[model samples]
Target: MKTNTYDLIIVGGGILGTFHAYHALKKGLSVLQLEKDNFPVGSTVRNFGQVVPSGMAGEWFDYGVRGLEIYQSIQQEMDISIRNNGSIYIASDTDEIQVIHELSAHYQTKGYDHALWSKAQILAKYPAMHADYVQEAIVFDQELSVEPETMIRQLHIFMQAKFEKYTLKYDTTVIACEDGNEQASLTTSNLEVFEGAKIIICNGYEFKILYRSLFDDSGLEISKLQMMRTKPLPQIQLPGNILTGLTIRRYESFEEYCPSFGTIPVPEHYHELRKYGIHILFKQATDGSIIVGDSHEYAAGNRLDDLGFAVDTYINDLMIAEANRIIPMRNDWITSSWSGFYAQHKDHMLEVDVSPRIHVRTGIGGKGMTASAGYAEQSIEKLF
Candidate 1:
């Protein structure tokens, strides 16, 4: 019997929506999760897979900490491409060193595990990183690295077998949603209808089409980030997620926690790099290839087309130039490169209640992969 009914109907199967489903199922709610494609091919899969709560600040940091817990707990059950490799932020100079010291102080009161490693300690662990680039580093070993491309898919499989109430409908697009006081219903592209007590939307940058005007009126901006992957190099030994100097200056944690974050003036040479929002993060994949990159270009939610589908070679050039300064690498090693788009509010995540029953949550920005699991857990609690 095609009852076409569930306790909860979730639109979009990205990190945020999927986590929402995970928590809802924990409450024993019958869930129908709809995905526009065969599986998630958005920000959830397109990232450095750095689950570093150490890089987050304020409430989001709390969420990220909880996110780390959820990810590890899931790892205990299944092989989800998760590695407890830890995360490290290497200071390039004395100025960057000062901020990391203050960051350590901020976390000390919070009871998070962290350690400051000296130059020799850094060299002993990651020999591939240039010795000269190391001033000092703060290590968060509890942080994790996940293979983004496979994490969500494995998670879906894990959930299906564990929770019989969970139903995932991939390649199913919700084209229309009708609001109701008794029961809400949505129609898919195939003209099939689904009914549930509540509906939550977690589509990343594809923000509109469903409720176009609501998101456009909302203060949301989309950022297009460019990233690259290197060919497998068996000799290299770059462990964990390596966030360099630019990252130290850019992450929300440093800006909010470190007192000296604003005091140090970035040199003039960084102007061009900063203009494009360039930050270098490297993580070695299971294939032994190092993933490097990231440069940002932004536009308002309604103007997503302005940030086209094309990858800018110049931005990749700028990233590779910065990568050379951090590690010993040749241009030939960079085998593939691409771009990923994420949406964010300038101040925080864009959360709007379309109604008491319908919720729109997205614009999680760069923190989606790190914080969504925890954030969604809290959100589900509040909603229920």
Candidate 2:
């Protein structure tokens, strides 16, 4: 390759793209990463920052396990601020408890370590929890959490400072991609051309811009969510990544559990919450602030404006109320709230070969944070 030519050209600057860059650099491959905006403002930063392999299954679960290892290695090598907070999923109903029982058995077969706690044990361990609804819990001691608000930015800074093979281009949009017999050339918004042996597009949910036909035909849909964060509560200490019964419905790991464990009989009044794909999960940020969310709605397109960025106050309030029901808070004072968007497909992730040398990966849904890095590494190895 020429001096100016890169070994790999990675499109997008989100976790998927950056993790690809990280792995490529690990293999001593020169990389050029492009981002349309000055920084990442998508689902990469607007999430609970919970990296829980316990929430995934099969290969995805393995990906999450590898991702946690990567997070740990990066944090130890530098200061990426990864916290080993672990995760606790509470079962509020009999159906949810059944899922826990089945999942626990499944975990044992898979060599995943976790503790199944009775309500009494849970109360003894965390007396602050509201015991009225929670009957049992599963504690995943290996789960990890990071500060989503700052993790990506700090990782980029670390890469720039620590690696000489990496280059990041902000405010740069890829306008065209042409693959040759042995290499690919990409034209940016500035009309500048760059060449690489392989071109990997990790644009996240912004699919239409680069490859509209492939994106449209890939069966990808948009998922919009509402999330909120509270001001730093110096007096409060959240146990870990707190998950409620609704999570069993949203997360894929509990799918088998659902069929065997049976469906949860949600209250008649709370039917609207279920209709909107709402779930309650909480995590404490490094600043001592609490992060709570979220509800899901599918969109026809991948753009945020078409789906709208407005946070539904009704849904937001319902989520906050549910969180309060689980753990009594000192105050319900929230400092920030917003809507987040990501890509999803009914079956598998939206990954396809746009050309012989050009590849696109997105639509991993909410599992982006948990498994993007590990999956990206695997994908790149297969590609090269």
Candidate 3:
């Protein structure tokens, strides 16, 4: 392989890296993006494909809205697949219903139209739901979903077309980054070295390995979430994003900015069994198949074992039970399941640090997809 130099070098090919690359190229900076895998085999592709903004903190609400607008405009201006399928956070219990009411009030104050639904209205819209299980709902008509894998693939294509000078090297991993005061040199796994005036590390979970010294005291921890995709049920009609009261409690805005009802304790019987930190978010893909899941388990590395299977099964069972309450249909055909890891810090906001020529962006928490474009733009403004 030949060694080359560029104005900017991005360390990861995931959504964040690609997004930053796209923005950087638009600034007319010669850019190169390196990825260890040929395709995005990370959490970027494994997630629910949900570009959710409804539950984000107030500080990041604008970023979410901006990113949502970017996705909505991608098809018209650029090349990408984004579906504004609209999402709803359904409340089943009285406490959850109260949370929805509070969220509606906060969103209205923020000029967002989060529609508050009465039980009668919800029943009229979704008659499949068990009357007893649904009390109210908050519908975010602007929330959307996309096939993440497809989006990434299309982004690369679009980048190639728009920025003919941009370079993308797949199956090339950055083994080491030497950050000097003026510039950085990136040595790849194949012994290929590239130097850039500026380098942005967007390696997601692999950040600790590349910059362990910088983050030694940052208190960054990796969160592993298990998720599963169910077999397509021809009869099931998932109208929107489905969530319960637990989601409202976990999301800070709903608790602090919105001041929702007090947290409800999980039943003692299900606490240990379910490991239910928050409620499940169920959304259907363009295909009839429904993607259900999600249980948070934090660890140092992306590791899995037989014990995780039990927990995954428990989570799937819980989601099925909740889905049945809303849409009673027992099609227990599970197609496949997998787990992914995301970076989380004490503060949910992403951090961007720039020192002359070197730039760093990370700590997106789980909202990377939701605010990547806006965050990348912010980074660009600060760096340039």
Candidate 4:
């Protein structure tokens, strides 16, 4: 028989929503996750799938640590296409080295296991990196890298087989939600109604759709990025997640080390790249293909066409040119390029309780993959 009612109703099937389901199942609650499309095709799959807690700050860093634990636990239980590969931040100049030293102090204070590799040590292990450009490197051994395209699908499959009470319905659009003391009613696009004790909305970028009034009133902005993946290159052997000087300014964790960490000036030739918030990060996938990216563009009030959503060749060219300078990769090696959009706010996340029984959570920004598992567990605990 079809389940007419569930213990919890989760909207959206992205990583955030799926993690919420995982936690709810741990609570022994029957879950029904609704996805508008066949599967999640959002920032969750578009990202680099890098879970580097070293790039986050404050509570977010803690959440990242817990998420890392969750990912590792799942890996022990199943074949989730996970990689325990670590991350390395290559400092090219003295200024970048200063940022690394400051960040190292904070990591040590927090008891995060890390090591500062000298130029000689870095070259000895990864000789492919330019010798003159590398001054030092910070090695984070606990970080993880996952296959973005398969992780979610594999997770969903695992949930279906593991939890008999869990149900995932795709191509099901939740049109309206009515909250009450006893139970919450969700009306789908087909006018089919289902009941659940609680409703949680996790539709990431679709903030304005289900709750238009609240989203309009809230100060949520749209952030778009342009990224590319290269064809499999058998010659290159990347040591781990490769981060450059631009990333030092981009991630908040570095700034926690030094408030003025992001104040370094951009070189004149890279003015156009800086205009779009371009950063060069390279990661070798399991298939030996490298994932290269990305430039940030902020759209106010979800402006879809004002450069943020569009994939401009000029901006992509600048990113390719910059990546080439960093690692000397062939421009023609780029096999595919695309754009991704996500909801962002100045705050850590946008969590709103529409009613006593209805809650909406999103605006996780770029830390979705890194912090979702831990954050969702805490959210579910508080909700119950």
Candidate 5:
């Protein structure tokens, strides 16, 4: 290949795109990454950054664990901050308590050491938590979190430094992609053209816009989620990522893989997809502020402005309410809140469709942070 050309051109510089670039370079492939935005402001940044392996089911669980190992290795080798603070799932109801017990038993059988914590034990370990409503809980010691935006920025800088020959073009949008006999050509909005032997689309929700033909029948849609961060609270101390029993009831790992938790009724609006429960994951930053979130709303297009302030207030109030139940803290200031979009697939499995010289990785759903590295590696291996 010529110096200006590349062996692979990756569109969308999110975690998935960056990981694809990283691994492709490791395989000795000249790579070029393009992003429309200057900074990663999508789901990659607007998340709790929790890598919960125990929450993943079946093959995805293995992938999550392997990805964590890779993340740790990379953190050590590359000087990044990955906090393995662990995670705790609090059960506030009788059914939720039963689910925690059953999930603990199931994870133990699967070689995972998720421990069941009695209400007293939990309250003792984290005295800030309100144990009155929590009947039981589950703790996963291997779970971890990171500052998502910082990690992406550092990774982008590191990739550019380590792979000087690899190209990263920001403020550049891939307008069209065409496949020829031996290579794929991409035309950017700036009218610049780049050619590569292979192309991988990791554009998240925008994947449908770029490759409409492939996604039209694949059951892929966009999910917009809301998240918020509270102002600094000196007294608050979260021991780990916090999850509610509702999460276990919704995630497949709690149901099919473990077969411990009984089904909680899916919300009426989300009945078709069988999605219920709110995930109130809390993690404190270095600045003594807590970031909590998220509720899902799916649509066919990018819809950020449609988020009602009332909805934001409602969710934030709910998050703080849940946090106070788990930790004894009072939040006075609401620092900031925002929303972002991610891919939602019907099967809950990421799919990589390959043409002769082109590949597309979509359907990451909400697990992009946890599964991107492993998924990207597998996609590259299948492509080249």
Candidate 6:
């Protein structure tokens, strides 16, 4: 390799790309990371920051387990705002309660620790929770949370300070890529070229840049999600990740593990929830404000703009109303809201090598935050 060459060059600065760079650097491989923006503002920053392996299944769950270890390991080395607050799933009705109970048993069989909490215990811990809304609860105390807005930035800083083999470049868009017998090369918007022994493109959902036709035919779809946060309530306390009944019904782990799942009847009134793919979730930020979200709406990869950039007040109102049913959050107190987007393949993640040395690993969808750390480590090993 030449002076400007590296052992690995990672495209995209979100969690997927950064984690790949982290592992490459850990292996003593010289790494170069490029981000189109000054900083990451995609799903990595927009998510609820809940890292619950209990919400994942199979290999993804295994990846999330390792992700938790990776996150805690990073936090211990430096302050990256990692919290072991755990996650609690509040069951709002008998069907939901049964689903959680069965799911708990499934975990018990797997030797994963879990506790079934009575409504009394739920109320005692979450004082603000609606008494009638929670029929039962299941708690996983091993899960973690992070301050999404700062974790990546701080991780970048940590890498700069700790790893002499790492280089991070922001506001640099990769415009072209080529794979040669000896090295893989990419050219940025400035037409400057950098070479690497292997190149991995993890640009999240933005797929049209380097290999448009490949991604267009790769069965990728973009999902748009809505999010909101209430005004700071320094006096109130809602610790850990608060996942509600809708979440229990929707999270993949439940669908796969819970025998009662899909057997529960949806009342006519809840049709809209199913129509919009709404799953109410709450996570209190470090600033004492609660983060509320999210509803999913999708469009084909070629029609990313069809998902639209405008925030839907009706969706927010629906979320706020549903959130109020579970917790005492006042809609008028919600100070800020935004939309997040990510690309996903319905059956599996978008991972295939366009060339032997030039690899593509975008479109992991909602699994990115929970499993990216471990998945990227595994991906790096396979690529090299």
lDDT by residue (tens digit), candidate 1, 160-211: 9989999998999888888787888889988898889999999788865689
Better of 1 and 2 by lDDT: 1
Clashing pairs in 1: none
Candidate 1 ranges beyond 4 A from true positions: 1-3
Across residues 1-384, which tens digit of lDDT does each residue of candidate 5 receive?
Answer: 222478999998899899999889989889999988987778788888888877877677877887788788778767655888888888877767777777777777888877888889877776666767567889998887888768887788888888866899888888888888878888888778899988888887764347666665667667767677878766767756777655756666777754445555434433422341356667777677778766777654334234332455565566566556656535476678777677777776545556676777766888878878877787678777
Question: Which of candidates 4 and 6 is the stronger one according to lDDT?
Answer: 6
Question: In model 1, what lDDT does residue 325 have?
Answer: 82
Candidate 1 vs. true structure, TM-score: 0.98
- Residue 335 displacement (Å), model 3: 0.9
Q: What's model 2's overall lDDT?
A: 0.84
Clashing pairs in 2: none
Alpha-carbon TM-score of each model against the true structure: 0.98, 0.95, 0.90, 0.96, 0.89, 0.98
Tell me the spans in candidate 5 whose CA falls farther than 4 Å from its real position. Answer: 1-3, 207-209, 258-260, 263-277, 301-311, 328-331, 349-354
- Model 5 lDDT-worst window of ten: 268-277
Off by over 4 Å in 4: 1-3, 259-263, 305-309
| Better candidate number, 3 or 5, judged by lDDT | 5
Better of 2 and 4 by lDDT: 4
lDDT of 4: 0.86
Q: What's model 6's TM-score? A: 0.98
Tens digit of per-residue lDDT, candidate 6, span 1-384 = 223899999999999999999999999999999999989988899999999889998899889999999999999999988999999999988999999998998899888888999999998998888898988999999999988888899999999999999999999999999998899899988888999998999988897788899988989999999999889887668899899888888998999998879889986656787688899988899999989999999999778899999999999988888888887777798999999999999887988888988999988889888999999889988876
Local accuracy by lDDT, each model:
0.91, 0.84, 0.73, 0.86, 0.74, 0.90
Residue-level lDDT of model 3, residues 1-384, one tens digit each, is: 666888899988888888888888888999999988887788788787887788787656678888888777766767576877677777767667677787787777889877888889878876666788778888888887877657887878888888976999899988887767666788988899898988888877665347666665555667767676777766666766666555665665676765544555554433643565535667677777777766777653323231243446666666566556566645456677777777777766435554556666776778888878777877777776
